[model samples]
Target: MTSGIPDSIMALVVKQDGYNPNPEGGIHFETMEPYLEFKEIAVPDLAAGQVLVGMAMAPINPSDLHFLKGEYGQPRRAGKPAGFEGVGTVIAAGEDPYAQSLIGTRVSFAATPDGTGTWATHAVAEAMLCIPQPDSVGDHDAAGFIVNPLTAAAMFEEAKAAGSPGIVLTAGASQVSKFIVALARDSGLDSICIVRRDVHNQVLTDLGATVILNQTEDDFAAELTSTMKERKPRFFIDAVADATSTQVFNAMGKDSTWMIYGSLSPETPPLPNTGELIFRNKVIKGFWLSPWLSGAALDEKLAVFAEVQARFSDGRWSTEVGATVKLDSAVETLVEALADPRGKVFIQP
Candidate 1:
């Protein structure tokens, strides 16, 4: 797979003829007919500033599922590759200066052009678009680290700036939540993690989270309220949004900054109380990775990446990827796990 596809290579392609953004069913609907096909096709030649990459590994992120179902973000054209994040090695480089610098290097890239993505074993990308993998990070960890770590890092800064006493993180057992909790601990702040099950408590508690509240437990709000009374966490990062969450958060003290990043809830996000804002100054906002990271320079982005990597190297930060799979199983693995309520799946492409 390191070598270029001489005649043909397999890829996941859109199967439908016409693109449909708002299909009858929502993004999670699995049509009996795959709009995309997994088949072998001839690989294209590299252009200037482009490099042929042998994809090493990629993670099955929530965004990947959304892209596949046509429910996340703006609707992309059908037949386009679905994955946006991955780590790959430069197998061939074009003549551009940046491309020349990337020869033989492995990197993690941002949004690649349509039809060129990490779902396949190979991709051709602009050399500058890739973030070189530091020598310290292994390929598996590096693959899962970039997108989630960066997002968590950004949210940490946001929470700090908002002047919250501590941060409340929902879906605290997920990979991204691990980074958020680790970052909060490093910053000398406490994190209150909200879990769906009691079993998830040990994971966050071992990671230094002070409070772990299982949403399924009875009178969870009373427990949360009691904890809030001790040391109020004015900042909340909800990777899971639902009506119950809205009610629980509404019960928080005023002047809190709540940022909703993911919608694990089947229902629409619950509306925030205007009274909290009108009288107490509570703020609720939404966050999407593409929009947030879109305009950042590679160097600037790498700085944050470097910091997070150092934390990992020092054994201060770590993510629990519950499962690992080979690159060939990318689609099937993702379809199953994205539907599951727990665990981070890593694809070693």
Candidate 2:
């Protein structure tokens, strides 16, 4: 280890061969015990463009769960720490000037594409991926800096660029959906939010959801069809890629587009509405945050980081903390807490 940095760091890591996938296909208490193991490992050395971050906190996103199952886009590296993003102070830097400049500065960073992750006392990241955090943005919000916020901003931009009169969003109670709903409200674009629980989702109206509908309602299909016809929405941004998503896409008029970003449901949806594709100009596509960020211009990324900080600092966005798991107990406690995931989950390293 260099200078004062410790020779060893405590991390919650996965054992490659020992990783147990829940038969049900998601994280579950019964089958998740071996998914993570708490260990004391040697500190990783920095590469030329990397910096060592002493992690303060990291959020548990759906991507992390998918990662545990080897279902996410990136392959999970066993024996390494397991977190995608976090807020921390850069304690050490590599030979590069940009990395050196970040030393001792507190920032929010995304784990490198193939690096040991942030669920540890110290983590390594490329300097270019780190965003210096403003004092006004608290630790909780900073922990969730990139994934949800950036995706929300990018998807909202997609909706606007599509020239859609309104957009349909599934999983209305989620943080990303709330941010998009608020953005649409400010931009004067109509938004329809769909959720399972009527009582809990009705409050979405406060976040700028022009219409909040319960998918389980008896007359949901008729009501959605009527509203879609009236609104003439041409874009459906979906997280749940199930039969319901297909139903929502079918509700829209001709020339509509369905953009799927996540698959919260285990079932795969089929392209049953081929007539719309053949006759009309309706299309189906996807949106992934990784490529979008990598493909964005430097100025655009910087502007997004600045705007995200401003929004989180000014109360326009709040990443609510539901549970903060200790590094040692994460192997077991995390699965139970995520059963409901009442608010955002965090790991304080």
Best by TM-score: 2
> Per-residue lDDT tens digits of candidate 1, residues 113-231?
63276766777677766778776777656676667888888888889888787888888787778788878887888898888777777777778887888878888878988988887
Q: Which candidate number has the best lDDT?
A: 2
RMSD of each: 3.1, 2.2
Q: What is the clash tally of candidate 1? A: 4
List model 2 lDDT by residue over 52-80, tens digit each.
88899999988787777777777667888
Q: Model 2: number of clashes?
A: 0
- RMSD, candidate 1, Å: 3.1
| lDDT values for all models | 0.71, 0.83
- The TM-score obtained by model 1 is 0.88
Deviation from native of the Cα of residue 209 in model 1, angstroms? 0.6
